[model samples]
Target: MKKNTLFVFALFIFYFSFCLTTVAQTRSREDYEKLGHVVWEVDTKEKIVAITFDDGPHPVFTPQILYILAKYNAKATFFVAGNKVKRFPSVLERIAKEGHEIANHTYNHIINRNITSSTLHSELEQTDEIIQSIIGYKPTLYRPVGGMHNDLIINTAVKNGKLVILWSWHLDAEDWKNPAASQISRHITKGIRPGNIVLLHDWIGTEYSRTSQTVKGLETTLRFLYQNGYECVTVSELLFRSEIIDQDYFNTFPIE
Candidate 1:
């Protein structure tokens, strides 16, 4: 009887694991479709660009980034993590106080794509609340960790009133790898054009040497945008160009 009970327990574990995996994957294909359709870039003829930093509000690195942006008189968006904001409310305060946009990057920077429903729901709310507490307003933009999201995650966020933000593939700076700042500057400014959204990481969770390198590269990048006559604006402002008057924010228009 003991052996039979043990066998049943193992079977139950297998069944539960299978169900979880299936649920996670079932919405994934639909999620991929919706994800591709979401705003990857905006249509505008203005010489303006959007610079977005993800996974940030780091106590040290974030302040460094803010200094560079302020020096150049540029405006950009920060997609901050909830837990990070909780620990570094002052950093978020400085971001808002300085006139930069703060958006949601999730409460915990979960890289795993197979997140449970409860975890996804909690992540959205926790981060939103933390940001609201710090900035006095909830964010309307959400960028998933590493740009990974399924149908459930997208629908949940949209239902909760967030327009998912995804960057163009050709425009990523990939500073998370800690390459020389010169390399990062080139990746972003090379062939950079209007209405293009460039991705960079401000907070990589640890205050590493390479992370500092990304910060170092930021000045050169802002300089490029400044000299090139491209106005560095928040992702929301990028959509606010004359052709698209007003904050056409969280627009459901997909890639044509």
Candidate 2:
């Protein structure tokens, strides 16, 4: 009886230690991201990356992007705004029909910093409804405007069964700034690597500069990625993860 009791106590201690380790890693491990609040990038060595656009369904730029993507046979993820999707459901349908991923970018591209729970949920649901109405389903990825998020946004989004996403700060093309096309292309193509998620824009924003520059940058960026044999995939495909194990430090999840 004494020996059996000792064995049971040992097993309990091992289990307790394991749990503690897991909890610690979850809180403090920048090395591992198994998808909760946000997945900035994926933990993989594959020579693939995701090219994502946000805040759009632009009548002009979206079609141009689609043509470019089709030319390369590349699949991209688009985080579309609800109002814009409502305005251009046919474009969203074309995006889906072309085998691109249509994700949620909220209703109006509002900042996620102090929005109420009800507002957040409403935005998400309304956007989702618009997307579903067009594409027959909604995407699981949720990216807030400007890559901003707080606990409220994360928790609310997770509760709604969606994963929050961000992109590499360095990989952002800054197309929204209406920079020169060559500058945007050079900024992205410099030192590109596997598992990088590049944030771009397809929104026209009432100016030809934004649309024209983004399209030009995209054409150059795609050519660069193609010449180097890099496959531009969807964000969900880039983040193809497996179960976490003992000791591995993947350069994903760049959260502070």
- Residue 185 C-alpha lDDT in model 1: 92
lDDT of 2 by residue, 1-256 (tens): 9999999999999999986664312232243243445677665677788899999888888999999999998999999999988887788889999999989999978884767778888999999988888777877789988876665666677766677778887888777888999999999999578888889999957625334798988889899999999898987767663222212323223333
Which residue pairs clash within candidate 1?
31-151
Q: Give the local distance difference test score of model 2.
A: 0.79
Measured by TM-score, the strongest candidate is: 1
Task: Indicate the TM-score of model 2.
Answer: 0.80
C-alpha root-mean-square deviation, each candidate? 4.4, 12.4
**Candidate 1 global Cα RMSD:** 4.4
Question: Model 1: runs farther than 4 Å from truth?
Answer: 1-37, 205-211, 242-256
State how far residue 157 of model 1 sits from its true place (Å): 0.8
lDDT values of the candidates?
0.79, 0.79
